[model samples]
Target chain A: MLLSNLELVPGRRVVKHLGLVQGSTVRAKHVGKDLFAGLKNIIGGELKAYTELLKESREEAVERMVKQAESAGANAVLNIRFATSSITQGAAEILAYGTAVTLE
Target chain B: MDLILQNFDLLLFAVLFITGYVAGRWNERRHYASIRKREDEFAGILVFTNRFPPPSTTRVATVLVSGSAVISEDFFKGVVAGLYSFFGGRIRSYESLLDRARREAVLRMKEQARAQGAGMIINVKFQTFAIGGRRASSVKGVEMLAYGTALSPVGA
Candidate 1:
């Protein structure tokens, strides 16, 4: 599977529109991490907890998006994009979407 | 009685510190694990775009949350209080969390677009909400959403 944000790939040629594809995931980190993050606040620095979190969430969403594209039999996906929503205090939703197309 | 109160404070602080440390470590571990798993999943996929898509084009794709995520009440309250203590003033930890979530989501989407061979993404959008109950003084979980489209070149 291929994914991109631009409508067209730099060198490849799109042959057909494979239709729309998307992927999403809902995630919740353990509370114990939150407690450590709170302590980090006192020391003052980077919020490693949240950094790790967003990273993981982003990967999951991308994976799902790729799966969707593959299922659609798309040779590539163009103009990929991501969206996130907070479902609750500990949980978040990550979503990825793009246009599935065939490449010549 | 004074001694007892002092001891209680000490115990509370210890608990808070330990909890915080544990939470941070656990969060880090989970993050690494998730990344590894996703990388394995994406190993076969290709990406093309590295930046945001240019404006002035119709969106060809979109993604949505379509669900809910909840933070533990205890964790939410602790984060709020921790932020207050660190900042020494009113701070919107929840809002910050929402904003971070949105940004991260968009970044991931861009990554996906790049993998798929797109030059840009557009039509980005966001939404947020709090699940159930009235607004309380303590921190509560919030839901944030981000969406957009990945665009490839016209001919390709």
Candidate 2:
């Protein structure tokens, strides 16, 4: 399935709108990674562990959203957007949502 | 020995301050240099915030592309920000942090588009947020994500 974060695909027309589809997941940092991050606070730089973790979470959310679109008989997901919220001290939720549609 | 024992906390604070100052400065300089060089290298690819791609006669395929970066504030920067908060003025140190995060995110998105043989990205959107910043005095970090649709000719 194709994905675009725009209202309409440039060269294609929407044949059917399958309404909104969304996926979300919540994750907490590993104890070891959190320990390393604490030390990194002293001499700050990129947080590779957290970055990778969040990236994976986001990809999973997108994958689930794609699955929903596929099940709905949609060929594409449009106007895709992402949201993130910290659930607690070490946990966060990543969400991916978009309008599912069939293109012609 | 008595003096050292009594001032152990002070000594550790001093050491952490010095290390943070020196290491954070060096890291910032190196990251800025790398960012500049890579930006120049990626100048050939076009990025835009327009909602729609330009009209094209040839068949083109479009796909979503995204990039994200997370950076933490050093002890020195956090201390500086604390001081700035007292004065009720702009926190200059954080400006650089946010700038770096945004630039890095955009660069990564461009890299992905390049890998996909896409010539341009449109409708680019950016999202920025603090990671695990709820607790007081916790190590604070900012995350920036850049996402958009990349357009490339169907064959190439």
Candidate 3:
């Protein structure tokens, strides 16, 4: 599906407005990744494990939003936006939302 | 018992130094290489901007593309950090941690846009969060998020 944060597609025309669609997910860091993070703490560098956790969460949230848009019969999702928050010590929540529209 | 007690500090330093020099350095080099490779490969795809429509594209559709990275500090850095703390100067070890996180996040976002066949990215922004953030005596991790609107050309 075509996704964008723009209200309009420059070359295409929006023929139908399917309204809003959204998807969200909550995730917790795993022990293995946390262990790796702990090890890295001794040397000080990027935590690949936690990064993967958030990345996966984002994709999952977006995937759900896409599913919502598809159910609304939208060929594209527009004005896409994301929000993230640390819900607790080891967990986080990611939310993705957009307007679903049919373009011609 | 006396011998062991006398060399405890020495043994601790040796252990930290050995592990930090080997694993920490190895991971950093490998990660840098990976980041360099991906950045070069996606150079054309990233039209990083903060303006909408990403002028001069067919603009078939737009989607939000994002990447995130979280990294921790190694023990070797801690040793130097201790020195820097006393000298009252920049803590250089933490700089690379944040730098790598940002670069990695942006690179991932580009990869996402590429997967969707986006021709351009615009209105890019970054979000950062620290979990148990930078304190003198604790393990810390940071999250860097790179996001933007990805635009694809029409009929492509």
- Local accuracy of candidate 1 as per-residue lDDT tens digits, B16-61: 6666556644653464465466556544432222344334544334
Q: Which tens-of-lDDT digit does each residue in A39-69 have in candidate 3? A: 6787766766677777788889999999999
- For model 1, report DockQ: 0.06
Tens-place lDDT digits, model 1, residues A56-99: 77778788778887887887877766676667665667777889
What's the ranking of the predictions by lDDT, best on top?
A: 2, 3, 1
lDDT of 3 at A48: 65
CAPRI quality level assigned to candidate 3 from its DockQ score: acceptable
Please give the distance, in angstroms, between residue A7's alpha carbon in candidate 3 and its true position after superposition: 3.8
**TM-score of each prediction:** 0.47, 0.97, 0.74
Chain A (alone) TM-scores for all candidate structures: 0.90, 0.98, 0.92
Instruction: Write the residue-wise lDDT of candidate 3 on B39-77 in tens digits.
Output: 899888856666656455543656677778887767787
Instruction: TM-score chain B for all models.
Output: 0.46, 0.94, 0.85
How many residue pairs clash in model 2?
A: 0
Tens-digit per-residue lDDT, A1-104, candidate 2: 99989999877899999999999999988888887888888898999998899999999999999999999999999999999998888888999999999999
Q: Which residue pairs show collisions in model 2?
A: none
lDDT of each: 0.55, 0.91, 0.79
